[model samples]
Target: MDNEKVRLQLYMARCGVASRRKCEEIISQGRVSVNGSVVIQPGTKVDDDDRVTMDGRLIKPTRKNIYIALHKPSKFLCSNEDPDGRSLAIDLISPVIKQRLFNVGRLDYLTSGLIFFTNDGDFAKKMTHPSSHVEKEYVVTTKKEIPEELMENFKKGIYVGGEFFKMKSYKLNGTNSVNIVLEEGKNRELRKVFQSQNINVKKVHRIRIGNVKLTGINSGHFRHLSEREIKSLLRDSSSKNGKYNNKGNRHNIK
Candidate 1:
């Protein structure tokens, strides 16, 4: 049997337009057109022969798939453009590999850490899916000490901003720094969770994602992920009974 045609939103994501969900939003708003007709269905499939357009401009699918891990510095927005004219995450990547890749997830302007960028639509979708349950580890420095009571509250899952925020794992590392892991990448989640607990976050740095570590990768630099690393990530995409299993080994990075 022939390979199935890729989903239109995945194609849009590969073109660096936006995330898969945002691409669906754009399609539903009639901003995307295929073969001279607007497409609103998220599950619409497009093959190599199909012509796709966004906002009346043709979008050609990229031939090369690039994946890189960027040690993003502070003051840079994790986006393609900022109306305020601030620097973007793409500006940090080298011109050679910077053509169609986009940040898989977001990091706040003030936060600095490892962020993945890629033009591989399928891999991006697998990694960012809510069901994937990939763990994001952060090393956070707070202005005040994290009380033991608050740590207990975190274990029990605290309610903040009308949402129940919970950490998969949390521990006080130093006098004022804590290491935390969470599967959900909600906007400003780490900062907001601490703010609700009356703790001030001085710095937030993502140290790890899934089994990938930020070790030896300097700030403001990026390195491409190896094929082995990519396969490892794909292998660990499933979660069972709230625990992630990788080849019969249980690892709770989340």
Candidate 2:
């Protein structure tokens, strides 16, 4: 129907460009055009007949949404393109999947862990949003003896380089190893916190995200998420600790 118009950001997200929020950023930067005119407003309406182009290439909504969990190896980038020719994490799954997909959140280049790639923008936004309180578990190994105050300070909230960092939970596995859970999963978070105390981190491996576990997957391997698993993840975002909360804001998909 010609009357079935949708927001530009939502339209772009449906096309597998990125999350709706990211599409808004891209739109604001005037990277999207509607019917041959640049449209910077994210709220601009468009229908099936309207021509939409991103970076001068026409794009349409993806018919299928794919969600996959990947066991990303260390030293691989979580980006679509890198000017320096560094290895991209997406390349590992691209040849097999053959679809336009983007990472849900991010893992630093040198950090190895479980990461998700999908064309569902709403899922990406929900997983990454702060209020969702999705827990990510990582196992960290340090070169030196673990600091006694490290866990306490991080749990209580520590400031490094003027940025506040905190852990949802922490458990010491051994003298030099510990398991940490983070709700925010800030960029290079563990490294920065450890570096603040002059502690050298040997390895940082992410093992879990929400209800999803990386137990059976080997490094560089990927698997499609089961329908139940996808529903569980979405459920996790809406509830915490067996209680439902309405504190999180959500974007509507037209």
Highest lDDT, which number?
A: 2
- In candidate 1, which residue pairs clash? none
Model 2: pairs clashing at backbone N, Cα or C within 3 Å: none
lDDT for model 2, on a 0 to 1 scale?
0.89
Candidate-wise lDDT, in order: 0.81, 0.89
Q: Estimated TM-score per prediction?
A: 0.87, 0.92
Q: How many residue pairs clash in each candidate?
A: 0, 0
Off by over 4 Å in 1: 1-6, 14-17, 239-254
CA lDDT for candidate 1: 0.81
Question: lDDT score, residue 61, model 2?
Answer: 85
> Can you tell me which runs of candidate 2 are displaced by over 4 Å?
1-3, 240-254
Q: Write the per-residue lDDT of candidate 1 for residues 1-254, one digit (tens) a residue.
A: 03348899987877766678878998999998889988999899996678889989888777677779889988989987799999887888957574767788789999999999987667777787766777889999999987877767876677777877778878789778889888866778788877987899999999898888898889988888988888888788744323543444543221
**Model 2: per-residue Cα lDDT over 1-254, one tens digit each:** 24479999988888889999999999999999999999999999998889999999999888899999999999999999999999999999999998799999999998998999999888898898776778899999999989768898998888899888889889998799999999877789899999999999999999999899998989999999999999999998867523424434332100
